[model samples]
Target: GDSTTPDAIRTRTLTEETARVFRSRVVNPRWIAGMRKHGYKGAFELAATVDYLFGFDATAGVVPDWMYATLAETYVLDKENQDFLKHANPWALHAMVEKLSEAADRGLWSEPDPELMDQLQQVYLDVEGDLEDRVS
Candidate 1:
């Protein structure tokens, strides 16, 4: 008997879950070690690394509001992260934008930092535009 749900949806759900499990069990430990070796500091760096490894899905609802809030706060306060943000990978910038936008849309953060959101949006737009130009 066929289920009412679509096959694509089911497959995507299963794949995402499997990936999450794999990240937790296998990738995270090794990634942590590497980050430590590279002298990465603070929870924001760790969270960014997780987002990079897992790949951000705006529709997946994987990133929590608390994480977004923490990221926003860190972005403003951490001098090191401030410099790193300028050179962040395109994918990482996109992930940060998606997560922060999601949090803002849901009114998850009590007071969303407009400056932080604007900075991330600018980076995301610039990176995406650059990619598009490269493709074109």
Candidate 2:
């Protein structure tokens, strides 16, 4: 007999299915352009973050989709909270990124806690140095 529980269901998600669903959506370039507001520096940081999280060996494609799903879910669960995470600290930011990487490793992407998000945002902002100037 198979047990049915929310956690179990989530744990059993198929990586291939996740990837297929993402590919069909026809992503909007505006979003990528928006994220590019950070420019190459921002892009580097995000790439590094993803690399660190999901192990640098292989399966990079799977990790990004998981990252997107995690962020999307977080956004849906608590938009306000996610916004706050976009405003967190440096050390905390690095740590949250690591957590995300770990989640990706386990094939279970998830949104960071508000506190972790805060740290990540803060770190990125702090290291970014005058994000306003860079974005514009």
Candidate 3:
């Protein structure tokens, strides 16, 4: 019976309703505080710092596919959100690629728009390249 609801519709509705709340309550305040303390300029930088401080599994090289898929479905679909990710640190951006790859592998989330995926992938590559250059 419950199968009557389409996955895309459910996901879109859930994300639209909760995205603002999640950003305001979970993301923004902490970002503002971090900006004050660490000079993070935007959402991407803040996400990277938070990921670094919390030591997300990707830091340990153990990315969970379902989690990444969920993140993409919930957070990465919007242009503004994707822009925030563009400025993310290398590790964080790499984690996004890993997540998206995992989603692709498992067919977990709906297919993201091709352009959005391309943009995110480009950002990931740019950040990774920058990090590599710094190390070299």
Candidate 4:
């Protein structure tokens, strides 16, 4: 039967291709326009600003699990937990949608369920831990 597998593959390919475009169209221009966007005076400031949203250079090729987790976690975090997302990598649309679906299923957006919150928090922490291990 026709299934979501093919759609998933197509989505993955599209995400990778568009990420390259984002690097050129979004990342590049963000640097050029840094003075307006972040009041930055030079490349250093622009680089640091983009670093938060784009992840490290190596992560460009890998899917960003952290962004998806951030979206899921956002529904459950207290103010302190939200602060953790500043370090999250920007995830592809595919991952974000998947996480959003899971978050919805767990009712994270509709209610303050502690069990679901724990699950989302663990996912976020795990992704960060994995990234750290890979980088180190």
Clashing pairs in 4: none
Please report how far candidate 4 places residue 106 from its true position, in Å: 16
In the range 1-136, model 2's lDDT, one tens digit per residue, is: 2257655653324455444434432123344344446644544444444444355314543445444445434322234433343443333334444545456456555444556545445554554564455467
**Local distance difference test scores for all models:** 0.51, 0.43, 0.49, 0.40
The lDDT of model 1 is 0.51
> Candidate 3 overall Cα lDDT vs. reference?
0.49
List the candidate 2 regions with Cα displacement exceeding 4 Å. Answer: 1-108, 130-136
Sort by lDDT, best first. Answer: 1, 3, 2, 4
Show pairs that collide, candidate 2: 53-101, 85-117, 88-118, 88-122, 89-118, 89-119, 89-123, 90-123, 93-119, 93-120
lDDT of 3 by residue, 46-98 (tens): 45433432233334433334444445543444455554554444455466565
lDDT of 4 by residue, 1-136 (tens): 2245876544345456545544564335343344234332332333343343334323443324443344344322433323323233312212333344454454433343456456655655655565567679
- Tens digit of per-residue lDDT, candidate 1, span 70-119: 55555423445444543444344445556566557765544566776777
lDDT value, candidate 4, whole model: 0.40
Error of 4 at 45 (Å): 32
Cα misplacement distance, residue 117 of candidate 2 (Å): 0.6
Candidate 2 worst ten-residue window by lDDT? 74-83
